[model samples]
Target: MTDIKVDHIIETDVLVVGGGGAAARAALSAAQAGANVRMAIKAKWLTGGSTATAFSELLAIAAAIGHADERDHPEIHYEDTLDAGRGFIDPELVWTLASEVPHRIQDLIDIGLNFDKQENGKLVQGMSDFATYPRTCRVNGVTARHILVALGKQIKKRGVPIDENMMVFKLITDNDQNISGALGMNMETKEITLYKTPSVILACGGAQHIYKHAVGTSDMIGNGYAMAYELGIPLVNMEFIQIGPAAIKPSMTLLSGPVWKTKPILTNSNGENILEKYVPENVSIDEVYTEKVFPFTISSAAYYLDTSIQKELELNPTPNGGVWGIMPPGSEEIVQEKIPKTNGVLKAKGIDVFNDPFEVALVAQCMNGGALIESPDGTTKVAGLFIAGETAGGLRGPDRPGGNSLAEGQVFGHRTGQAAAKHAERSTNSANPEGKSHAALEDLADWIGRSKGKQELNDAIVSLKENMYKNCLVIRNEERLNDAMTYIQELEYSLENGEFNIDQENFSAAIDFKHMLTIAKSIVLSAQTRTESRSCHYREDYPEKDDANWIKSIFVTQQNGEMSVDTRQWPHHRKSEKSEVKL
Candidate 1:
């Protein structure tokens, strides 16, 4: 058998992986800093990630919104974020992001990206949350993607070497745990790419796809997070997950979650106004509903608020693809005709989103925290590696406040890229960071050439996704989680031990599934550790938030085949003493 050789060795001051907002920022920042960088994202050139489809970004344009009296400075934004995080976030990171985000976003605009504007030409902020002011800013209602498109064009113009359809098999390193380089496979040729570089930034989104019915795409299998764990990085707050704002995807045309106007009458199928049941504090219509329901809803049905009283005209938040889509912006006729699929889903499930009372589950959208931040410079505990964006934890600790994700990506992504570039500039090496032995190197060489034939990678990938969707979705218990985990593990094991084929279509996909399996286990294991109910770490056995002992982040690590977890209490934010945090 012929062995596949390293196609080519490329050296760079930095390597930024993934195409989401974080990676875009990383690539642009590093290149602007005069570092040679290579960018890679899984899957092909189209729809690479959820951020690709993310119509909103909460960070880049907050203070520039249309609301004339909006008091949105980074400081106020920081506090609101801290409060939303439940204080589990590392104050340093939160403070850093909050302080610089407004400026950072403005910088993005200055760099050729344009945010959507109102009739008066002010930057438009969508109905976003997490601050005393409106924060989610968009360009024609698509924030990150717009930024992504711009960055892609700019990066291309600069010619800073990027590989499309490149699957990151794993991070390659030497004995010192310094990230030397990475090994990837090209989707077109089914070839192995073992490129060595000094520093790397991992911005590969989150592993939300590990769960069934995820708001994210199947590509968000947490490869970066899983690879970090495999290579000895401490992942933090893996227990905190975030379901979305609505029971259905915003992309859904017909059936949609209620609009803000319907809050006064929001109810579940059981005829309960969720806001009243949870807050009991007679709040106004504009308060974040997640903040009200998250504490208890995790252990119970997600959201079943009563909205029976709202007039038909004022309730709708639906959209069709592209622009000019109505968000339940009109009357019931729009929903009935345009997005009847979702409407039918609601009606079939006996949900009356229109009536005084209706129930809808805010499906698990994404994970908020994971892979503890060990670097003040955004470095993981791993020497040669860095983590940014959603996969890297320590942004918001307790619970992620709404509208802060895009900011963290931009701010920390900038930091991670710069720091990594500096590290690359200082270092000079061409060996694996983990000191791969001769035998290990030989094994890698052997595995590179070992595939035989008749492998259906897509089938396995589909099965894994379907299983995840079915078993690990909105609600779960030990029995179901365990079953799903086992099934996933078996599939991973089969791939590892099988002798079917090489370079076959399913080949790289199988590799992807392997990574997905690791990520899936991380989710299940992390979920199993936090016995106390809080936020998305809901437990059927225990249905109440026990801040007494469970406020800490659940940390997980895996070695060989065993997984262990350690918990750390949520950081204490002394709200009484206005101890200042400044830009």
Candidate 2:
């Protein structure tokens, strides 16, 4: 084994491994709890992760503060979330998110995060799909960015050390399987650093970028999921990834909210009305458009619209790999009024919504599944290692309601940060494990010693992404999933055999390929194992929900140097104050 030198060793009480909204919240809470906190981000602070990059006209955080409608309550929010999850959501997590998000929102407000309000000084709230009332809180459609700005300011105020351009690839555990520290590489200097901490929070977001068509930032490539999975953490609901319509041509912005209400004409590359051809006879275009809000789900007629576009692109290939959406001449004013943010973004890109045809495609937006947490505090089965944000699963289900993603990050980020700090306070074994550190360095050295050019590695990533997009996006089946799994395994074999080239410049890419392959295989295998059509994970072979045998959540784990798949019954029977909602 080639010896690799560790350039630096840093010590902290709690190490946060992401820079998104969740990570910011975690770091802030940890610092507030009086724990020495440090953050390692693969990209620049406040410039990466889904929370910083996600945008839409209706972008808001779901909180049942009863601002828009007095009828709204946490119970209603919990019920709607449970129903939307399609029998796979954890009841406790849903309740925690629904009940505690209001407090978290208030915390944000207390920290100088201003939400949009009406003339009466009442907060403005809008209704999102799968929501009972107008409970989504927003600020001119860029709510996430505003939230991040507030969070970034608070994070800076707390004096938490943040390490940017640091890619954490390994989680070091002691002999008792407790998290001791982590190993990271600085992307700029190519130097290795070991962070010694008693507690760690994995909030690195999702791997939607593994798909060819994704809306998340490039840094969100499954670093959290892969690291947790490698550490024997069970990943749940890996198959249920949320995908939705977004512009692919002029700019990569989400096509949601009032844009659908405008009744824009959707066409194939040849200008054929694809929706008319594929929408069921019983479903009208008006119904499809009305039902379409954001993410693609099998329960609604809007799926026909997404399916039509997918089929059209497959049959008649477009240069941009999307269908054209043309807004009516007079509807431009309505779009400008209703979806002003989306309209402004597109207008800046030189595509007038009234005249030019915009390219739209089904883009992977978020993952509903991730490392399964045992509590609302984002506690995984692994000791001293917690998860939050998109990195933690079981909190969401097959379909997450719009705006809940941001709410979930705050609710659980606060909880996880506090829990991790408490755990760190009780921890006595803060010493770095030399054995694990040496092994991690040896592994890094092996990769560096096998370094070659970057072309082959780049080609492999492109091919994997294309395959994942084609086989594992909105629509899926057993054959395609199996084929994808096989291809992924072949890629894994090639990577192990050093068939693809890797070098120092592309070392992050090489590590990303490994993480992507691990996550892709997990998704494919989990999708195949489910064998039922539900929510975002629609298996065409089994075209309907099999409630009898498939009401359980699928879990993927690494065991004995191979992938293991299993399922566990959801805790639907767990008693709670709001347990009246049934599957």
Candidate 3:
């Protein structure tokens, strides 16, 4: 407690709490609209958020895919999004995203987002599976990264105040539920920051790293999700976990997604394309693989590697799940380099993905749903608080469409910022009823400083990650979940014995991993309760969708350190007082 420091104060009309594509755009939009906005990021600005991991990182992704002419209105986009989300989406929320997506795409282009174009200046496009039109778009192949880079420079040009390498411990609100601001524990000096503002926006990204082996970065620990839930917010789709289909011995084959045409034939170690035995006839090649071969593990897993089919397969998007599809040119190299990164763990476990694709397993990648903050127009049940990008719900279900999330960041972040500003302007609440900001900051700073126990943080996290990889990814059953829950309990008990020493940067791996454990518990709990398979939550007991029994949303909220899950019935889409502000 003595080591704690209270460093600074940041006040703004609107506070954007993330640095990714969505957060950046949100801040820029708000600031440009004359709102005094400040953004805070937990890690290196864009690096920690989802904008860094998009498929192509292109601007106007859907436009590049095919809707270059605005032929697709928000209504069409809304229906397509709702359909993809499989009834779990918030009707009004989907309406919001769909309605604004097209104009937002145009806004990116207007702001110097260099999307790919043909000789005639028409947008270059392709179909990345299941899209209503050729909606998959790209510029340099990595849409997420490209957008991050561009948005990075774009925001830097605007000179927004940003604080990085800080841990936001909790959301602070007055008794009236008006968001006064947030409290943060500085990683460097163990001091805390108390922010008093009209509005608070959470742009914190997904909770994928909570699982053992993940393509997601270390910072992807559901911190934002946890904070929102702690504040009594509902997470829309907590059960939808996205797992990539390709792995060579437990290492993901990033480039392999675009290679080897026509769903590589699944072959066992015996070099047999296992599709022959179980894949029923009449299914499309994509269906034959994703719906049939990919799920079944015959003695491990089997996959056909045909370099010869590269051209044919790349033409048809192999990563058919997301809005971002594999673009040509870099497919082989991306696959080649990324596939081997999984070696250390796989080598330690004795599996070779190249020689045996089946031997390669899974690590966690992304969670499609989370805490229900507000729509782009920042108004949660808890007013004065807003959610952005991945932290806010009603965007994706268990399975997210590619390119859509990046778009989400732009649209919602901006909306939330503006709405928050509007709320602040209209609200009659006082900033501080009893001066809690300073107290809250000091308390958090002290708490962060006091984590000086002597348990091995890294080892426990590694174990947690490994356990999650085996139990939670791709294949899951009740027994596995139960075992994992028990294992996590013992691990948590052991963490109390470790030596923390309150080193922020030095002990970030520990902090990151600890947060992962917390988030993993929620995921497993939600996954365990659903008892049925749908989209990303594929339970062996309930392998098929039963709309009659499970047609609504899975609302998971955490209270009193316990996660409570409930089923929300889908409501008819209603249009609220639609704002007149259009890009």
Candidate 4:
């Protein structure tokens, strides 16, 4: 077989890989910094990633704008973030994110993001389950969509070139382990394109789709995480992922505060309330149900709500294959007001939240982990490579505050864009580019050309998702986590034996299979190592958060095709004494 050649080559000062809110913000910021930027997306520009499809209770963009509460400052926001993280996040990163978020929110407003406001002209802020004040800013619930639309308009106005339907396959690095360019393949034509640039920003989002019950775009299979891991970048917080109840049968929409406000009784197939039996007798069940915390959190009592449901699922497999949500009456207005997008989903399914008991289950939602970055500028261990959004982790630990994820994207996206431009300007190699990008494409094309697709490969992928959900999701145990490891190792063995094929039609799926497998293994590995139960990572055997011993984070990196996992203490032992915000 001949070496596969790149069909097209594009040169830019910086490359942003993703089309979500973070990528859009980064691209626009880079262009504003007078950098020639090119962006590649797996789908269309604005509506392709998780930001566009987010359908939970009001998608939050947390910023201490002091709209609702004048006392809601960055210090309070930073404290709340630390409390959510359970001593696992870097204090500096959290401080940086909280400090800059208000400015980033203002930037979004400048770009035409119409945030909901009160009659007094201040932005209307609301509270999630865990908040010192109302810091979550939203637009009737579609915060992500509106943010994307606003950033999309800015990118369009700035004239940044966007390559749609182009899936970035790998990052090309020079001999010094410095990122030089990237290789991508057009989804429609399967032709390879090489992007030559000094800087690459990874906003490719998270690996929530690694589970069978996932809530993000299908394309978010941790491509960024896998590429960074393969390139020897250490990833932190792989064990921590957010899960929440979402509609299962009618359609997948977030069953958030409003849905729970209807006093939905979680029942088995026989219509018996299941949660009463599992929750502690001392805990108030009403408060747990009305906690307004969508994500299953170990730090709060609401976690019992999900644990009880999981218990029921194990004992009796329901006819619908999920726990039934018997929503109380008079919820129509609340549903419409809180989650307008979910209202559409319910209407399309013909199951009114006011009338019917819909099937709801705990589904994997947001990933709070990714390639570790050392600075607020989103600089990764790999030079010339940066990351933001869910693709970067440092500000979040065992869990995240309600709106911090989206806000982190905006804050760091702006910094990364400017940083990439400066790096591009400082780099000396501009006239003559290397062929490593083409070489990477040739390797990928060679793998794609050789193999015949197999049904077993697809089945294996399904099994991977099932194993992760069963063992590594909301509830986990030592035995089950070990079982997950075995299954992942066996799948890896199959890949080594050439049992799977990379046919053109299943090319992306096959590639995603590899990424998901790696990411799943890492999650299970990290979960198994962390003996204490903290936040979303609940271990049944280790049913306590051991702050004395488990306050540090586990960092995983790869060398010689093997992963090395180690622990690192949080940099700061105490909060900063200064009360003034940095920005």
lDDT of each: 0.62, 0.86, 0.61, 0.81
Q: Candidates ranked by TM-score, best first?
A: 2, 4, 3, 1
Determine the C-alpha RMSD for candidate 3 after optimal superposition of all C-alphas: 7.6
For model 2, the superposed segments whose C-alpha errors exceed 4 Å read: 1-3, 450-455, 577-583
The CA-based lDDT of model 1 is what?
A: 0.62
Compose the digit string of candidate 1's lDDT tens values, residues 1-583: 3444566566667888888877888888888787888988876543777667653223233442324335555567667777766546776676677667766767777788777666976666644445576666667545667777877786777787878878776787776777887877788787666667878888888876664445556678777887788887767776566654344433221212333322324443344444454543444434543223432234323332212111110132212101111223244665454345444555566654455123233344657776777754688777868888887887755466555777777887888878888888888665653334334445654654665535566667667766654445444467767787798777766666654454545556655677777767667777666666665555556656777776667777775667777766655553333223211
Q: Estimate each model's TM-score.
A: 0.77, 0.96, 0.79, 0.94
Candidate 4, run of 10 with poorest lDDT: 574-583
lDDT of 2 by residue, 155-206 (tens): 8888889999999999999988999999899999988899988899999999
- The number of the candidate with the highest TM-score is 2
Candidate 4 ranges with C-alpha deviation above 4 Å: 280-284, 329-345, 430-434, 445-455, 573-583
Candidate 3 versus the native: TM-score?
Answer: 0.79
1 or 4: which has the higher TM-score?
4
Q: Supply candidate 3's per-residue lDDT for 377.
A: 84
Candidate 4, residues 1-583, lDDT tens digits: the string is: 4355678989999999998888888988899998999999998776666898887666789888777878888888888888777557778888888788888888877777788888987888888645798989998767888888888888888888899999897888888888888888888987878888889999989988888777767788899999889888888989988887888775577777566665677888777888777777898888787764767878677888888777777776476557887556666666566566666778788876666777877788888778899888999878899998899977778777788878888988899999998899898764334467656656666766555435466788888987887788788999999999999998887665556776656666777788888899889999999998987889999999898899888888897889789988776534665554321
lDDT of 3 by residue, 349-411 (tens): 554333423322344555787777555584687777888887777767755655566667777
Q: After superposition, which runs of candidate 3 have C-alpha atoms over 4 Å from their true positions?
A: 1-3, 56-60, 63-71, 188-191, 246-257, 260-361, 374-376, 427-429, 433-453, 491-514, 572-583
TM-score of 1: 0.77
